[model samples]
Target: MRPTILRNIAASVGLLILIAVGYVCFWPVPVEPVSWQAFVPPGYVGPHAANTRLSNINLIEIGDEFGPEHIAIGKDGRLYAAMTSGDILSMDLDGTDQTIFANTGGRVLGFDFDASGRMIAADAMKGLLAIDPDGKVTVLADRVSADDPISYANSVVVTLNGMVYFTQSSTRFDPRKWGGTLDAGILDIIEQSATGRVLAYDPATGNTEVVARGFSFANGLALGSDQQNLFVNETGRYRIWRVDASARNIDVQASSSQARVLLDNVPGYPDNLLRGFDGRIWVGLFRPRNPAADSLSEWPFLRKILLRLPRSLLPTGKPYGHVFAINEDGDVLDDLQDPSGLYPETTGATETADRLFIHSLHARRIGWVPY
Candidate 1:
């Protein structure tokens, strides 16, 4: 306990602190983040108030299956779940009669049934694909530009005439190397590069065309009842865009009338879109917006420094559950929530005759509420 002994110990601690600071400040990161003005989220209040309705729902266990990100009702009237294990699960409404209908060997974020009863998936890793009734998988469109490609192919919807519309969540973060789908999404939103796009793939000609571009993180997609419009979720900016389905190319902010914001300044990050039988479109708010992140949106330096720190220390959205239904005019008709978030990360919902199947990004079991 001499002065020299204490001095040496203090010196060692000082050096360690210096090294840690240097690593955090000078480390190179893959994303070159940009700053954008992020509006403060309207907290859960009034119609969007917190409740336990979703938390008390019945859970259909998927055994070891994790991350049932999306659900679909096939032509056969059975439930199909896109699981994190890279397998599309076919089962009854009660979670029985489970079968691995098809394995895409990649993540299927969203899928829909084509007129021919083929399951079309927007695979984050493999690209757009088609799975036949017999479990045969086929790559439909892996890349539009061999150079830049569809980096993060996300939610998809099939038009009655066989056109497939999907969203590429980001052009900067490729889910393949950016540490999976969720990680890549975080990077894209943090970067705010606005490179996300909407695309159309035609099966007849085997061609793909850009429908709309310049989105921060285009996530989910749903066609309008008329099939002439498409609603897309832009996660990074907390908005949903309406794009002209027939437009071959257009920027969201262009002078053309092809693209417009359907719903701006959402309360949280919108994930997926599902058309309910009630003539309303259900939208999933993946995570409640973080106040700290919004406050730092205009501060590029602060965001970049935070990104350089350990991800665990970074500001992130809360798990407060929220989802709502909106009419074609973007009027919110229903808001359901569970502030306790028993089934966290409610990504989307699939409505049927007797129940509403709640989708989650990382839940072990699928949740359902008697509608």
Candidate 2:
């Protein structure tokens, strides 16, 4: 009787093990990872060397709202910030008399002011939007056609010619269906399908055209001082690209003179690009590079397995505050680092004469440091 009982127990243990193995091997996941070579992360050295520069940030409380993803000073000189709550709040530079400017009802990751004082916004879930000065919201371009819609509209810049250029972070992963921008972005990066593209919309003609295509995860955009080149942050590959604004439907993957990598092998995931005063472009490193994620880039199967594991076990971006400024020549001009990451998800900086307003993706308060 004892021998029979022990055999039954052993069989039960073996069955449990088999079930676990099967789950790990074939369980469906949202991301279908693609194999790609990851660049070796350059440890915080050179211009990005570890420092306490961003450690002392002054906070401006926004009470209950969080994730000030992008901030732009309007023509009226009031600071406009796109919050996570879908409310664009306008306030004084010192954070006084804050009031709701407009609510797009969709997340606006980045925005720019047009020549006519309209706020051109890149809405992640709703596509490109235009908010007039009187707090009226309008959809500029949601889809090129019924079959081909903008999946994830990201950053925007309106040229002097009334041409609106924005980025579609991924054509494969829709943010609304995948549970917001960050989650969808992670899935797209893991998949590495490189469906991100740069598009231009002519406000006069109400037409949209592709300026450039083929990026792993395009995050940010900043028109150059000359307004001829568009600086794009390709987040998945940790690099910044300088693409010609005039190039139509240029594939960045192919050997094209229309586009070139500006900053390569960044130490962290680049988030937003803000052109500052005097030809300086500020870039926010959302999170420091994860060595484990980089290692799994070449092992697509392992990445899939990793995703199948518990969310706690999956490799994720560590909270580290890092932002820097670069010139058009790809030279690092200023670097700020906060290893403690207390200020959280520094998306980028908006530079003024006296202060540098830091943007974040998950902070209740806006941070700023003396310029």
Candidate 3:
């Protein structure tokens, strides 16, 4: 009925599309996408097949204290959990006598007990922390160097000698500003900046130094029983690495002989490492790898374009409970799974004498299954 009007409308729409395309293509995002070689993840099968063993876990409700990402048994023979509310919860084995042990005012994704009965935590906002029995919290190490500080402090391990080793999940995304740990992790993974690193803190010397660098997202750290090596989870690459405990000022990925890949092509984003009853290392696969994300990994331009879009529109992986027991040599002993995702985002599992306590990043309660 109106050809001229229809032409004008069409031109306007075309111009808008052009502008949108240009913005997406040339956006100056913080991430400088790296062209990484990502392989297709293995389907849930064989030793790592799907199961519902962790489906009907007994939950210890934390009320509003949510997101218990890591758990450890304290010297008092009680359960202690690091929660999203920046509080460490202590309770009996049956979830009784619940008490707020201490609040770090920072998110603690992982923690371990030192020989002195102090709980050493790797906090996302405050860096390494030590909480004594009297609820006293001390900031151990917040920065590696003035230029390259620890941005995303993650999982930590304390040796019997009191040396602390921890992971910096991302140097680019600070969890305090970029949202929580998950949000910051998404940005780091999408950017592929390889800024993740590992560091060591000597309590006696009051010094901190970088142990390794050049990981996409170094997520977790676990010291071997021999105390000679450290197992680290590289969440962005779906691999677990073994770094020499004595490694000093080395880049585990770029140059260096002290570190080696212990496990490769893992089924999902390896989240944390926990020492089991018999030197078995328990690892939680936070979520299965996203097919779309992997497919775009080789194409840095596509990743950049993806980053330009709203994070809500991005293809993120759905939650599925999965954990595996492994040895120091990367040998998988067993896999526990809940394919239906009854309990989502199983980050790691702490094995006690009688039960297994599961950690989560989203669930409102801590899950436990009989050992």
Estimated TM-score per prediction?
0.95, 0.98, 0.97
Predict model 1's lDDT versus the native.
0.88
Using TM-score as the measure, the top candidate is 2
What TM-score would candidate 2 get against the native? 0.98
lDDT of 2 by residue, 110-176 (tens): 9999998999999998999999999999999998777889979999999998899999999999989
How big is the positional error of residue 161 in model 2, measured in Å on the Cα after superposition? 1.2
- Distance (Å) between predicted and true CA of 39, model 3? 1.7
Alpha-carbon lDDT, every model: 0.88, 0.93, 0.88
lDDT of 1 by residue, 23-100 (tens): 777777777778788776888776676666676788888889989899989999899999998999999988899999
Ranking by lDDT: 2, 1, 3
Judge candidate 2 at residue 260 and give its lDDT: 99
Using TM-score as the measure, name the better of candidate 1 and candidate 2.
Answer: 2
Per-residue lDDT for 204 in model 1? Answer: 96
Residue-level lDDT of model 3, residues 1-371, one tens digit each, is 59999999999999999999999999687677888889888878778877888777899888888888999898889999988889999999999999999999989988888887899889999999899998899998888767766778999998888888999998889998887888889889988888888899999998898888888899978899999899999999999999998988787657578989999999898998999977689999899988888999889888889878987878778878888899998989878888777787989989999898998998898999998
Of the two candidates 2 and 3, the one with more favorable TM-score, higher being better, is 2
Candidate with maximal lDDT: 2
